[model samples]
Target: MARKRGREGRFVSTVEGAEFFKVYLPQFSSHQIRIPPDFTKNFRRALNEKVILKNKDGKTWYVEVKETPEGVFLKDGWPRFVDYHGLKVGEFLVFRYNGSYSFLVQIFGTNGCKKEKFGPQNIATHVKSEVESDNDDSSSVDRSKLFKRFEEEEEDNNNEFPKRPSFVSPPSRRKMLKIPEEVMNNENVHLEAEVNLRNAEGKEWPVNIYTMLNGPTFLGRGLCAFQRDNNVGPKDCCKFIFGNQTTIDVKILRH
Candidate 1:
């Protein structure tokens, strides 16, 4: 029997029961609802109860309070664990926690039939701030807005860590490659190298080289180059072409 109190059928309006007045029907009890976003609210209050959030380290935990931080996760499993792992810091985690006590946790990330490991480091998580109070007619939450908030928070956390050296990408045809010419100018640097590119059929084609690093810079700046006729680079002579081709091995020998 759906009642007008609490979450119980919240003010059913339509005779078919599919619709309601004020708010949707509550699956829980009369005055109790799901937990508030603040985390301090009683998650198990009224009809809804605790939420089980799966962390990236492979374990589930009931989050009664959520003030620790968003990306936070528990790893290696906590002894006498409160479920399993908790999202504490570092990586971006998918964070499989029930958005609301009334609804079961659903897949909300890039996972497509991919058994989620909870939260993934460096990847972003989506949290929807989209819940409107049943009693209130003016206010409502949107999921998209919540996701943006999560991204901003993630950036703040990552900025505090040391920057890692990013690998330079090989230039494609028509792209200019910048190489450190200054470093090469120093004869002591001594890096003798040559590359010959051939087609998959073993046909040698004239290749071109555009940008070479003049030298290494203190600001971590280096040089690169582009590809053209009469130029040869590593990407050209391969066992297979990218996208349509498979990975091929290359043997470099000193004559």
Candidate 2:
């Protein structure tokens, strides 16, 4: 059973068990991921040589576990799991361990929204192609260059870190903020009713979306209170990160 949270609409497992979250950081989290020591302490003994990682869709991957003095790390087959998910830096993952060796994993993008799972066949084909390409590489220098280029391109196109939609508030629009046309067209935001604008400090202000006679949408009600509380001023640019339909994280830049 899954319970939904209001902030990002992420599903939380109702089953009581040991769970831990990790933010994917390529520096150390790419090849291997260490389970938190506190979470590992829940286990009576060492983990099995292999454990099952099941996604919400019921797909499972068998990953090798390595016990070390530092902590327990998911190794070996872990890279295939990462590649299959197309996991990127800053993405969050929650691992809930059942009493058995199986763990249910849920992945979330940087926007704080749960990521959609790709079909198994598609990911398998992609990973297979990647592995074949890697094996065919003869020149180390060429392979390294190609890898660097791939990383750069991946970073540029990563949806998890997409450029935030922003607009500079003019003096006349102090009481209301217009939603960008591109933002409305984007599925990341659902402005049918209202959205809560969250700041860096985690403070939130509920603002309503108003449609004008001309067909444009603007954040009207409750925006004044948000501006007053945040000290928003003219010429200040506000960047909006749509976490989901109900929540948007806001960042302000002073002019």
Candidate 3:
């Protein structure tokens, strides 16, 4: 499987899963299609969920559309996916790819009339914001209090007293999954890590991390639940081996 992703991921041994978190654009002469107000509204309406494919024998695919009209261009629609939506003035549709194993799509095209690459860094901010927003909505708590509390904690962390030079704090119970540096950049790399998580005790915790690949280019990233920790063992042991991407700050948005 590793060798397979390497070949498909352009010899990259890092990226896993063919476009796990990415939208797979087709290997074609990708051009742009100006947005029609109708399309803009409809594009997002069907993101990452099964939609009717253009020419499918009933095989629907998922799509990640970026509705852009201003700023860093690729400020990425997944962000103001709602605010910046305007499909009337003329938009571009690069190309599209759909997933077979899961409902996923990778779109290839331009943002604000310019070419764009579907990379991890490109979507990280949008993804992070979306995730936080989703969690917040679920809690629907006092938004003001949440922000104030978060700010206070942030400030306090910044004020933590320095420890003695000779004193080293114990390692975190979390483990970071090993991903080869080569994997982070290979556009075609597809990776899937079967993470096993165990808490400080000795109870088995479920873990699974998935990342997708673009064409034969980008070292993309995927959806992983390791913010939960990557030690797959007992529920109490603080030691683990194959885990990456740790969650430093945790917020109980729903509690």
Candidate 4:
């Protein structure tokens, strides 16, 4: 006798599902979403307990699948899962059931606003690209492009940091100081390290550190998380320590 073949992973979000996500899903703290009954029954019948949902960018979340009177539903981390991917009301989510209890989700955003390529991996790639650009003598990497990459990785979507501000006079904030040339220019500092700026309270803030072929180094795009956290404004003293070749500690001396 022939063995029964397993169900394949193919599911598309309907208008109803999109409506459910935008209209009502955000209201609940449980962060559960009702899976379409027909799709679940036909394609996901084997989902007995829980499953791991992963997006195209490799963000994974463990979601509980509960079989209830209404239908099979995904709970626990559903809301934040969608939010992290910047899913909107009109967007469509395509699900492909990969084996090993995971679903590969592809997001179809509205008006061609693709947010999938801007993951943490891309951020690392962006920094690496700068390192590559350092090879050519005539071409100088655009600082704006670097900042744009940082903007893409920013958690605060509403207020993306602007390009580095130029202050005509002293302003009301603490400013970040540059790392010493000895350390920044070291042959060892190319792409082997990730510098962290630490506050007085010992909070570590990560920043992208890369060197150019010319004699210039940038801490991060415009104003990085460290600057925002302590209100590092214009002309304030910001001190940093090279904990090691891989990490650096920052101290906001004054605001």
Candidate 5:
């Protein structure tokens, strides 16, 4: 078998006679999607219990594969994938097996065009700031005390730290951008508020945050203007830095 490096930097073996199958999602198909019996015959003996589903943009989701008399089906983690991509009934999905235990998936809407929301962006590495101090006796003592005090305060506050940087790739057709769940929970942003989106050039766009009754929070109202002014596209990745509850620094990375 021939080996090739994958996008995740791991070497994978090329499977001979790799195949592709398409599925048309019907009503109530969010929980689990069945794989065609004929398609499973291609590599049924070689199939693994767990498989990875990768989107066109290289984002991956691990789903459990169940093989029974009923045929093979994608189980756990499938619902989250459906919800994350906002899949609806009648949408079509293409799954191409990669010889390995992974499949590259592509979603198409009713218009027969690829869904722009599934076009993922590369997630940037988390960069942590390091504190520096002068190499002096008093400076060292002060730095040690500062760290101790910081740790004590963090413990007292239940170890809640500042929100880290995150990336968002908004769909071109969508008027609002969804803030990541981790960022929203960490920042305690659950109410409607007005915030400023500042770009790298110091240009600011006032955007309104709208919290849904039981859904995710989104940046709306002024997002279109911000996207227009920054020339944001579906392929571009925007890094969001939550400077404060009222300010978000955006750095657009063009492809």
Candidate 6:
């Protein structure tokens, strides 16, 4: 029998110059950055509780998800983490959530260089500044409205994630494949997951995996985004990891 799988989610954002440049921990209740609605909905942990943040190099940090009127933020270790990583404005940060409390953070330099680890050795010591309450300009974004939109959309659609197209036959017309009885007899599994596809250059690209019962077992979203960024093609093979807290690894055979 095949192994059971779990779900995954991701949120990629470019560091805004105004928001990420300076240490904002002093102004907030604890050091944290406002998280997206999807993040909060998926995790649903209580405010002021701790969550584990693992970096690409396997380093871990315990950070609290503090809920505020504006939204939720990752507090506690954020400032030191940011400083160590030398996080700069305009750099892209890819946050891959494991459909639970933990998140894997990958950093890309402004020039798209991959950074495996961030150490405090190279970073200058950050002196905690006086709490400047007025500097908290982030309060302008009304998170209640944003949260409402997500709630309404979830209620109306009843689908957690968006589904995209499945594997298509190439123009040459591939031969029909047979479905094994074991797979056919397997119970239907539908949930939010992710596929980590590696390009020719070996860069890890994560696409949203939406599983279904019929026709094809796995359908993926954000494939186009990965293709666009990585220039992947039908001839190139990829690897897929599916699950939430636990995961199963599979490979996509190229046509």
After TM-score superposition, the amount by which residue 70's alpha carbon in candidate 2 deviates from its true location, in angstroms, is: 1.8
Clashing pairs in 6: 6-243, 6-244, 7-243, 7-244, 31-75, 32-74
Two-way lDDT contest, 2 vs 5, winner: 2
The models' CA-based lDDT, in order, is: 0.26, 0.63, 0.29, 0.48, 0.60, 0.44
Q: In model 1, what lDDT does residue 179 have?
A: 29
Model 3: CA > 4 A from native: 1-104, 109-116, 123-196, 200-238, 243-255
Q: How many steric clashes between backbone atoms does each model show?
A: 49, 0, 53, 4, 0, 6
Q: Estimate, for each residue in 162-231, the C-alpha lDDT of model 5 and write its tens digit.
A: 5454434433344456676777777444332556889978889876565544545666557778988888
TM-score of every model versus the real structure: 0.17, 0.41, 0.22, 0.36, 0.44, 0.36
User: In candidate 2, where is summed lDDT lowest over 10 consecutive residues?
Assistant: 4-13
Instruction: Please give, for residues 171-194, the per-residue lDDT of candidate 3 as tens digits.
Output: 222222223344445454333322
| Top lDDT prediction, candidate number | 2
Task: Report the lDDT tens digits of candidate 1 across residue range 1-255.
Answer: 322333533332111212111111223212222233332222223322243444332334333322233321222212212111112222122322243422223232323332343321111111111111211321243424533443454476683313222112222222222223443344433221212234333444222222212322111001122123324454322111111111111111111
Summarize candidate 2's per-residue lDDT along 162-206 as a digit string, tens digits: 454433332223444556677777765665345688987989987
Instruction: Point out the higher-scoring one by lDDT: 2 or 3.
Output: 2
Model 5, CA-based lDDT: 0.60
Pairs clashing within candidate 4: 173-233, 174-232, 174-233, 198-250
lDDT of 4 by residue, 26-124 (tens): 443236777666555444444545777777646566667777787778875565465444444666666666655567766666665544542223244
Candidate 5, number of clashes = 0
Q: For model 5, what is the alpha-carbon lDDT of residue 127? A: 7
Q: Where in model 6 is the C-alpha error above 4 Å?
A: 1-30, 124-255
Q: lDDT (0-100) at residue 25 of candidate 6? A: 34
TM-score of 4: 0.36
- Model 1 worst lDDT run, 10 consecutive residues: 122-131
Where does candidate 4 have its weakest 10-residue lDDT segment? 166-175
